[model samples]
Target: MRADAKKNYDRLLAVAREVFNEQGVEASLRDVARRADVGLGTLYRHFPTREALLEVLLRASFDELTAKAKELETADAVDEALVSWLRETIAVAHSHRGVIGSMTAAIEDPDSALHASCLSMRASGERLLNRAQAKGLARNDIDGADLFALVGALAWLNDQPAHTSRIDHLFGVIASSILTNGVPVSV
Candidate 1:
């Protein structure tokens, strides 16, 4: 890409993140372009579609979460590792309002722009969950898909104004339910 085009792309992404943070992921693309001081055509040239733009923005975050899961693999306690990753995933989902909906949809839509990244992130969490289950720490009845759905549910709960104050307590409750031996080590 030309220097100017690259600059515009970077600016658009930065502004989109800000706008999405303030207005949720469903915020208008026109608003993003206006906030970035770029023409709508310019934004389209770079992103093509809303999902495309979101794919670029979310891919980095998903990669980071996946890497975090890998690092947590060697944590002293399998249960702690799973709970920590779940907390991180929920936090990321909550950071971008309405993103959990896209993640949930993407997981079911193989053709969605975010499908691959979401799948990979889910797989990473699944590995952690499996490890915990192997050690008889996490519940065996729940699978990775169930764990992923729980993350979306937790994230959605956090997005609710009335439930905001209850997130931490709710997280603890959910984590404890998933664990088998005892309460999950505080994550």
Candidate 2:
């Protein structure tokens, strides 16, 4: 990439992050271009589509989440490691506000730009979940896909004003349900 084009790409990503943070993942691409002081044609030349742009914006965070899963895989407490990864996944999803829907849809669509990252992240969480289940610490009925869906659901709940105060309590309830002990946490 040329210097000027690379500069525009970087600025677009920075502005898109801010716009998406304020207006959710579905925020207008035109707004991102406008905020970045780039023309719509330039944004299109760089991103091609919203999903493509999101793929760039979220790729690093997804990679980090996968790395965290790897680190947690060897934790002394399998249950704690699984819960910790779940919390981290939810945080990542919630950070982009309305991205859960896109992620969930993308996971099922191989052609989607976000599919690879979503799949890697899901597989990472699945590994942790599988480890916990192997130790009889997590539910046997759930799989990696289920864990991914749960993350999406939890993130969506966080977007609701009515659920804001109860989000932590709800997370605890959901986490307890996944854990075999039946008594996970209150927050």
Q: Any runs in candidate 1 off by more than 4 Å, and if so which?
A: 184-187
Candidate 2 per-residue C-alpha lDDT over 5-124 given as tens digits, one digit per residue, 9 for 90 to 100? 999999999999999999999999989999999999999999998999999999999999999999999898999999999998899999998999999999999999999999999999
Q: What is the C-alpha lDDT of each candidate?
A: 0.94, 0.94
Task: Give the per-residue lDDT digits (tens) of candidate 1, residues 1-187.
Answer: 9999999999999999999999999999999999999999999999998889999999988999999999999988888889889999999999988999999999999989999999999999999999999998989999989999999999999999999998998999999999998754453
Instruction: Extract clashing residue pairs from model 1.
Output: none
Query: What TM-scores do the predictions have?
Result: 0.97, 0.98
Lowest lDDT 10-residue stretch of candidate 2: 178-187
Over 4 Å off, model 2: none
Score residue 56 of candidate 1 by CA lDDT: 98
